[model samples]
Target chain A: MDIIVSKDLKKKFKLKHGQRVNNNGVISNEIVVLDGFDLKIKKGEFLVLVGPSGSGKSVFLDIVGGLSTPTSGVVYLDDKIVEAPSAKTGYVFQQYALFPWRTALSNIEFGLESRGVPPEERVKTARELLALFGLSDFEDRFPYQLSGGMQQRVAIARALATKPEVLLMDEPFAALDAQTREILQNELIRIWEGTDTTVIFVTHSIDEAVFLADRVAVVTARPGKIKDIIEIDLPRPRDGDIRSRCEFATNRHKVWDALKAEVNKAQQDWKLAPAFAS
Target chain B: MRLLTVLPKSRVAQREKIISLALGGSVILLFLIGWEILFQSKIVNPLFISAPSRVVLAGITIIKDGTLLHHLGISAREFALGYGAAVVVGFPIGIILGWFKLARATFGPFIAAMQATPRIALMPLFIIWFGLGMTSKIIIVLLSAIFPLIVNLQVAMGTIDADLVQVARSYGATRWQIFRTIALPTSVPFLITGLRLAAGRGLLGVIVAEVFGGAEGIGYMIQYAGSTFQTDKVFAGVLVVAVTGITLDVVLDRLGRHFGKWRSEAAVH
Candidate 1:
């Protein structure tokens, strides 16, 4: 049932910092963010990847979404290597990423337009998706005219419009307020149930990972690798009250425990980082 | 007892408009009255500074003789040829330079240098090559006007977010498709800016060309009347030029607004 398999993935970013004197060039630090990273995502499952800040969770997610290329190693979707971004896999970024110039409905129809869907048909499909997301009346409004939460909903609809087999969301609601974030979590769960697509969601929030994912994958600090993947055995069609349930608190605690060590190490490194420079 | 009555909001808005229009009209009327006072008293010498009434008489005489139309037509034609050609050529070149770094590297410095150099100084060279005909006047107009359009459109192209382009590419959109959907719509405000700047600069250029050495134009008429101490005729020519400049600015502002309504609406944020 596995739909995505990434093996021994690695990424390195070279940072050239400080001043340059006499045209001799400045110093650079090559940070290897991910190495020996391995993961398998099952078909039709909501897999949430949680990691400490700067753990390359988003970077790895981009690689899997075909938005970027790894320094080495391969990520496969149904036995095919993901080489370039295509309509097969859709991505939603942290910043909503809705086109400001486009109206709510037209933003959803963007992917359809790229795929050559006729105007009349794409409008119909976009309109239905807007209604499904409870934004039907705001279809004529631009992204700038919408609230942050409403814009994110449009972003999600835009990602789903092409009917991709895989959806990659990288902290899509990270910019939202706390109350809106909670509401969006429920909407995400609702939307997931309504579709049969495989979702690989990345987040830094423990409560979000536990509340939304079927299984949560915790990653180590820099040079990221999966620390643990915990399966949630909670009852589905779970209502908002489920967050107050004993099992919900337990699962959230479990993810927090796994992530705490890496976070502390990252903070300690951040403090000592200046002294350790080459 | 006089008291202000509270009108409905929309009607009050119209009343505000009327008051504004009245104030705008009074400004011009006051200036005209002051000039007439100064002229009738002969404070600055009547032969040098023409009275408003004499200038109006000169304007009417020129109109009836049909000489004013001929001069204005010549200047208008030169401006149209030069500025129209600049827009047709500068827009695409600016887009190409904006999109491709290599093209920008090659042409950017050259274009900047051309812009910085005073194009009016080239009029003597143009006169020698193309003669003091319509051709020379239009060439000067093109040189003066094209720079702002190119520079503005190029900068506008740069302001488009790279993330938006990446998103479009992620959805399998082609280069042409992406340009049509994203770059073109986004560059509209910049295009309007370029047009506005070019209109002002092109007006200066066409007049300068005519003043320096052109057989017939509003600028030529002014220079001819000034040398002969025909102050009324000179004032008439100046009035025509001022009116033409105001008309151009107003027309361009409306055009810019027509293209920019959606962008401005979104830009409220």
Candidate 2:
């Protein structure tokens, strides 16, 4: 059985009056971002969703994680309907939204504290997570004191501190420099290998999708639904050198082939943005 | 070679602080000297503008005679009571006004109208309602202090990062927990700013209410001295108020810094 499943998921957004233009000189900003989407995520599998910027992948991940409700669909987690946020699901955002007032350890302790874990156990768990993220030395430092990569690591560690069954990451390293991004990508694989948790990641980068995913699902342009799901047959411990391997490039090309049309469609939408924006 | 090395940023900062202090002190000293010279030469009448020496002597006499302390104590108590009431009532109201959309919609217009009205003009109404006593003074201070607190906190709460609150909610934080952990911390710097403004306005309120009617407190002392043409005594009262206001701001600035250390560190982030 799938660890997480979405059945005919649909998400509708009422855009501001200025968001779009109708051909008959009326503003029609009502738009469906996801239309009849279906996805089944297996246990302990790493799934990456690649799509255009407005393709509703993040919203879909949010719905699957129970942080948000779908407009017209059902999401099941472990055979139960997902309704609200729970300790069983952890989410890592693109922005690394660590509380500025909190130190790294304190931030990692936040989820545990909310769960009413005892202070002693909370501290121990946080320390262990910090060590796992290689952030033990920076435990006392605030998020601002750390580099972007380190902050993102802390964000991921904080998410994992609760030991959620499913980890949802939305473009976790999209803001990092190239070197940090590469380093963190490797670290994530290592961390994922050690955990039995299912991971669903959303990103705009095809290379990231190919590198990190057990299966890369390509989402179409807005009013989007899944176009294709491509499995990465590359062997693991898929290290840095794997990008140079023929199979890695082939898998990346496969994802790109599925994703390129949607990107162009999104661009076409933007080309007509002058009429919409005016 | 080590001795010839450049000074660290912190050391340079310390030196800059000393220089600023010296500069500020010199300005005050020079004003005092100029005032004394002009007064002794009778360029300004001694009766109209009291010299620095006479003001000091009057201050010293008031201290020795215990009258100044007595008046100072009354003013301090009135300020404390009024400002305390403002804080006790204003903070939660501000948080409510900030956090809840319904509350903001209900109270926003009323607050805006109230804030727009010059609160000093309401002194007669307060005096008539509460009499020329501590109650009137306290009410005046409360009115003055509360607007800034409410306005600043409301805006602060409104503008707090939605992503922060969303992240907390995603982790299963309840409403109250989110407020305490996410909203409150995010609102601290703004709250401190509101408090600082409230303190100044509170001090002003106490003195104004006291001077306008009350027979006790430093404001009354200043009024009584001015009416009797004892300019030096008036200056002493004025001096006390100035000192108290300055001290309140400095203490608050330090306190704000202590609570708001996250602001400096997280500013660029």
Candidate 3:
């Protein structure tokens, strides 16, 4: 049985402002953000959703993580229909989103505290988690005191501290520099390999998707739909050599081909008027 | 020995030390000279604009009379009670209105209207309602202080960093936990700022209330002294008010600085 499943998921937002000049006037039309998107994840599998900007990848991740409600269809986590964020599913946001007011250890312990973990045990567990991430010395330091890469590492540690069955990452390393991104990507693979948690990672970077995922799901442009699912068949702990391999190039090309036309079409439909025209 | 050697070794440190000492000494000297000149010149009626010497004499006289302590105590008590009440009431209401959409929609406009109206104008009404007693003075102070506290808190809550809130929610924090752990800690600086602002307003409220109608307080003493042409006593009362305001402001400022260390740490990255 799939650990996570989204069936016929649909979400639409009303575009109306909160104003009514006439009683009988139509408010506004609805804008569809996600339309009949379907996906499923096997237990402990690393799945990546790859798409262009505004293709609703984050929205889809939010739906799966129960951070958002779908207008239609249902999302089941371990056969339970998810209605709200739970301890069973950990979410890592694109911005890292570590609590600025909290130190590294405190941030990690936040999830444990919410689950009613005892203070001593929670502190011990958080310490262990930080040690695993090589952040033991920085436990007392606040998020703002750390570099971006370090902050994201803390975010990951915080997410994993709850020991959730599934980890939902919404472009978690997208804001980092290329060097930091690569290092974190490798670190992520190492962490995921050591755990049995199912991972659903979203990103627009094909390289990142290809580097991390067992299967990459390509999403079509706005009013997003699943365009294709490409199995990576890449071996564990992939390093820089994989980027140079023929298989990597072939898979990258395949993803680009599946994505290029949709990306172009989206750009065309959503293009802004030129500010200065000759 | 290392610390002693390091003190003036660096150019930056030496420059800062010299500049700071020079500025401090010059300010003190300027104040002393200005006071001496004012007393010696006596350009205006010395009786009306009492010299620093005469003001000190008046202070000694009030001290002897035992009324100075009583008035200070009364004013201090009024300020504390009123300001405390305002903070206790305003903070929770602001949080409630900020947290709930329905509450905000219903009460937000009313709060805005209340804040916009000049609270001083309600002194007459307050005196009438509560009578010319400590109760009326406190009400006046509360009226002056509460609005700023509520307004600041509401704005702070509204503008809380979305990322922190999201982080708390993802941790499976309930609404209450989120407010306590995330919202409350994040809004500390704003709350302190509001309280500091309210302290000044609270003092003003107390003074205004006393001016309108009060038997014993700084403002009432000043009014009485002015009417009897005891200008030195009046100047002494004015000085007390100024000192109280200044002391409260300085104390709150130091407290803010002490607490603001965490905020600055958060802002650096």
TM-score of each: 0.91, 0.94, 0.89
State the weakest 10-residue window (summed lDDT) of model 3 chain A: A269-278
Q: Which stretches of model 1 miss by more than 4 angstroms? A: A17-28, A271-278, B1-26, B264-269
Write the residue-wise lDDT of candidate 2 on A54-142 in tens digits.
77888888887777788899989998888899678999999999988999999999999888999999999999999998878888877
- Which stretches of model 3 miss by more than 4 angstroms? A16-28, A272-278, B1-32, B265-269
Tens digits of per-residue lDDT, candidate 3, B207-240, equal 8788778888898888888888888898889889
Cα lDDT for residue B8, candidate 2: 57
Question: What does candidate 2's lDDT look like per residue over B110-191, in tens digits?
Answer: 9899999988899999888999889999988999999999888888887777878878888888998898888889888888
Best-fitting candidate, scored by DockQ: 2
Model 1 pairs whose backbones collide: none
Q: Report model 2's TM-score to 2 decimal places.
A: 0.94
lDDT of 1 by residue, B1-269 (tens): 21222234698879999999999999989999999999999898989888899999999999999999999999999999999999999998888899899999999899889889998998999999999899999988898889888988898888887768767877878889889988998788888889888989999999888989978888899899888999999999989988888898889878877766455343522
lDDT of each: 0.86, 0.87, 0.82
Report the poorest 10 consecutive residues by lDDT, candidate 2 chain A: A269-278
Candidate 2 global CA lDDT score: 0.87
How far in Å is the alpha carbon of B117 misplaced in model 2? 2.4
Best TM-score among the predictions, by candidate number: 2
